[model samples]
Target: MEGTRRTTLVLLLLACLLFLSLLATANSQLRTDFYKDTCPNVESLVRSAVANKFQQTFATASGTLRLFFHDCFVRGCDASVLLFSPSGKAEKDHPDDLSLAGDAFDTVIKAKAAVDSDPNCRNKVSCADILALATRDVVALSGGPSYAVELGRRDGRISTIAGVQHSLPHPDFSLDKLNTMFTSHGLTQTDMVALSGAHTIGFSHCKAFSKRIYNFSPENPIDPTLDRSYAFQLRTMCPINVDPNIAVGMDPTSPRTFDNAYFKNLRQSKGLFISDQILFNDARSRATVDLFASNNAAFNEAFVAAITKLGRVGVKTGNEGEIRRNCAAIN
Candidate 1:
């Protein structure tokens, strides 16, 4: 009996020691000391890149979403979208919102510049590296439950503006249409609104959404019951001018801030973009949008979760892809 008891005690001790070892391994793996690791600050890199690119454009929604649209649509965030001409990987030129003028690489340049500024980025994070990582991180955080993203993605050296129209979701799409657009890219309707929640950050041009205001044609009908005050406000900036190049932010109340104002704007019928307003019109997503508007904490949490899911779409992990040295050039 004494020998049996001794063996049991020994086994328990070994189990405890093994558990402790596993805990320590996980703790070390989870450590995020930027000072020690050569890895650049992903959050900072993403924020900075987003800020830099969207200084002039995309004020209400996050530059992160814009980057996602750019990355995922063409080649699954392969950084080929960042490449200008001359590189082998050319994107088919597609029409985007008239406000963006179908420009490419604006977001990529900002991301690359941000990473380049970091001293720790040397030999660790490159423009291409940050592009891949930031794109993945933003998409993941904007969708479902947030997950940690893997680093080390290679960049490509080609960009074609062709076929962008097919890649981007149309502003005129209904909720079901929107769902199809997202699911086609491995996302859901929940992901659609959650990603759209990024509208809390940047701006949009009047030209992009003016049709919803003055032009009440059958193809583009404005909600007749929209708030008069908000309608007046939009008209002041976006006149009947044929060339509405003037960019007015979607969330005029809080253009630069990241918050639930976009949702609030939607409730007020002041959502600048047609796509934005459609959230409120849809029965399935209307309550969710209202919930987010009234409850910011809930919105923030959901937004982060959604973006994390968006990041994982078709990622090239574990030798599936190479890490490019430069974001603008091909590997």
Candidate 2:
């Protein structure tokens, strides 16, 4: 009889342990109030919308979608960014910055891909969810941190072109200017430099900075620190008379690989944009850039950490935002 009692006690304990395990798993999968119950396939919808808008533009649908998420989450994941105009201005004549069209589209697509890849994602994640997710993925892909992303954001009903122009920082801004712009968006100088690592993979047109390259104006000329050989190459593409959109990606070695090459190049003044050069010049950001450039393990870890934080900034939680049925059209 004592043996029988002992066996029963063991069985009871095992049952209790199993129940606790299951409960923990259930909690891990619980959907927060911020996220709307949605499906994973919405990424496809956003990709289609973006590709349809810019089929063969300088930017890829994938890259644009990534930018959209980054911008929205830097403060709050607000679709106000998608509402900009041609000159990077928001809510004006163009109603949407066509320059941002490619990047914006790409951001949404990648964000969805990241969330779908996560096994923990069970609820129908919306486009807004994708936006935050993509920001985390791209930054990590660029050798930055990968931080946690809070879900549950709603899309904006209205979009304006001027809004894009007004919001996006100028490509030629000094490190100080960039700090102001990023800080205004609730990001730090470290984030500005780290996130700007996006430039490592993407490219801009010659027309975008032709005024600085050819014009004798020092105030707007390309940063003096750029490699002379590289500068000459850029000039060849953007001649004085005919300035066209040319691809000058940040990573000259392997534009596709998201690594610390950007920081390595910056040390040599190979950074393509003035903003890119400024990061290395500043005391606060220089060390971080160098650390990432030298230590691959450290860079990867820090990149993930910063990106995760970037994804969750200014997010709308607990019923503040909605889940869009279709990411392209306003609901």
lDDT of 1 by residue, 1-331 (tens): 9999999999999998996675344233322242246654655776666554444554313554575555666555555555555533255333453343233255656566666667766434434345544544443333322335544443434466664546777656777777887877767676788778776655566666667678767754554646667777778887888454576666768766667888998887877666788898778899889888898778867766665555444444334445555665556
Question: Model 2: which ten-residue window has the lowest total lDDT?
Answer: 88-97
- Which stretches of candidate 1 lie above 4 Å from their native place? 1-61, 86-93, 97-129, 132-150, 156-158, 218-222
Count clashing residue pairs per candidate: 47, 56
Error of 2 at 126 (Å): 2.1
138-204 in candidate 2: lDDT tens per residue? 4444444545555455555554543345455666788878778777655677676666666666666
Predicted structure 2, TM vs. truth: 0.67
Candidate 2 residue runs with Cα over 4 Å from true position? 1-62, 73-75, 80-96, 101-124, 135-148, 216-223
Alpha-carbon lDDT of model 1: 0.60
